[model samples]
Target: MPNPAHATGTDLLVLHALRCVGFAGLARVSEAVGLPEPDVESELIDLAVAGLVTRVPGDFGGWGLTEAGRAADAERIRDELDTAGVRTAVTRAYEDFLVLNPELLDLCTAWQMRSVDGVIAPNDHTDPGYDSRVLERFADFHRRADAVCAELSAALLRFQRYRDRLADALARARSGALDYVVDDMGSYHTVWFQLHEDLLATLGIPRH
Candidate 1:
């Protein structure tokens, strides 16, 4: 029998992507769902027409789920999990993710700030040595994280997108676009944070 989770339509994919990622523009939404910009925009319009989603217009604006959309997503995702029979697998991965989550936050903090004389100060990127040290640590953390991501993807293919996006962020960071590590809007930290939200939402778990 075909897995019901794999039967999710594009509407659910895009809608839940917005739910996980929060407010984001076209490109980010497209990147999250592994869809093209034009396709995501079309689905957003459809979702907007149904009142489950809304679009904000401005330099700092993007798409977000409405209250109704949140409720709908909760119900649908639960159905997806139970119908697909992968809840246990997802739950186990979520536990592994919890172990890695704090380390990721620490890395992001190290990238953007630093400890000096017991005071937390913003990192101004003035010291190449300090920056390189943090970057190396992030790479090491990612290697450890890859295992959890792989486990999730093995159960539900949609999760593979997270792995791909995370890798892209690291690649850009390695190529000297250091902002991709944590500063850019869709940086590795940002994407990992969103994935955290996604895993919790999908598992019906509360965020701490």
Candidate 2:
């Protein structure tokens, strides 16, 4: 049977993407959902019409979910999981993700900070050897993380995008885009953080 949850869910994808990523501009939303800017804009406009999202115009403003949007997302996502009967699978994957979560946090901390001259300091990327070791650890952690992501994608196709994104971030960081490690908006840490939020939202779990 076709999963009703995955099929015809572009609107849900846009809504839930905003839910996970918080307020973001069109470019970020497009990137998050792997949709073209025009298409995402169309969806946003329609969602705005429905009073599910609103846009703020300013130097720092972006699109965000309305209160009704949040409620709708919660209800729909719960229905999606229950309809597809994938709660157990997703919950198991989430548990696996938790196992690897601390390690990734440590790796991110290692990337952003280092011991220098017997003092802890922000990583300045001046030491290629130290940076290389940290990158190597990130690569190792990604290998394990990929397995968990695979399980999620298998359970819900929407999750495949995260696996692809995390890989892209790691590949870019390894290829000398240093900011991709944790600094840029689309950095590995940022995307990982979004995924964490997504899992919690999809499972209807509170952040606390």
Candidate 3:
């Protein structure tokens, strides 16, 4: 499939991802864009050559946007929002997204780790009852997330991809792909993270 991030002919998606996530590995970038690692690496190289982004070499380091890249992304994303005439709508949707953000994080945490004996511990999936409860909450969370995605798609068509991706993640989780809940690259938390980035970028809102 063609890259949805580049369908609009702008690198704002990748640039803003770096802006929000700080620095990240190529695997993360590829997961976020639903593209292969090589494709994301190619784009990262081009951005680096243009002095808009930089690659950090270290065990814990990866790619990050330059100051210039951040500025460019802000300008371009703002312009795109204005051009689409969806600033007001997207802003409103973002407010709604914020309300759901904490709960979503809670779900992710519950999925990856469980509260046991008043201490947060990794969920080893030993207790069927606990797993079922978490899965139930996840299903409920998806219902609310659907509304946010709907509002976003209404504002900008490109935002529709998030709805599909998020649903796919949840579906995988339900189908016993436990990693899809959080740990895996295409997990529910990952898709939600990208949607959060998309909302901030579309509204030209800074992540402080």
Best by lDDT: 2
Q: Against the hidden true structure, what lDDT does model 1 obtain?
A: 0.89
Q: Give the lowest summed-lDDT range of ten residues in model 2.
A: 1-10
Model 3, 142: alpha-carbon shift in Å? Answer: 0.9
What are the per-model C-alpha RMSD values against the true structure? 2.4, 2.0, 4.3
The Cα error of candidate 2 at residue 12, in Å, is 0.5
Cα distance off (Å), candidate 3, residue 9? 1.9
Q: What is the lDDT of residue 137 in candidate 3?
A: 95
Indicate whether candidate 1 or candidate 2 has the larger TM-score. Answer: 2
lDDT of 1 at 86: 89
Give me the runs in candidate 1 sitting further than 4 Å from their true place.
1-7, 58-60, 116-119
lDDT-wise, the better of 1 and 3 is 1
lDDT of 2 by residue, 7-104 (tens): 42898999999999999999999999998999999999999999999999999999999999999999999999988899999999999999999999
Write down the lDDT of every candidate, Cα atoms only.
Answer: 0.89, 0.93, 0.79
Question: What lDDT tens digits, residue by residue, belong to model 3 across residues 58-146?
Answer: 89889988888988888887887787777887888889999999999988777778877899888889998888899889999899989
User: For all candidates, what are the clash counts?
Assistant: 0, 0, 0
Which residue window of length 10 is worst by lDDT in model 3? 2-11
What candidate 2 gets wrong by more than 4 Å, as runs, is 1-8
Alpha-carbon TM-score of each model against the true structure? 0.91, 0.95, 0.79
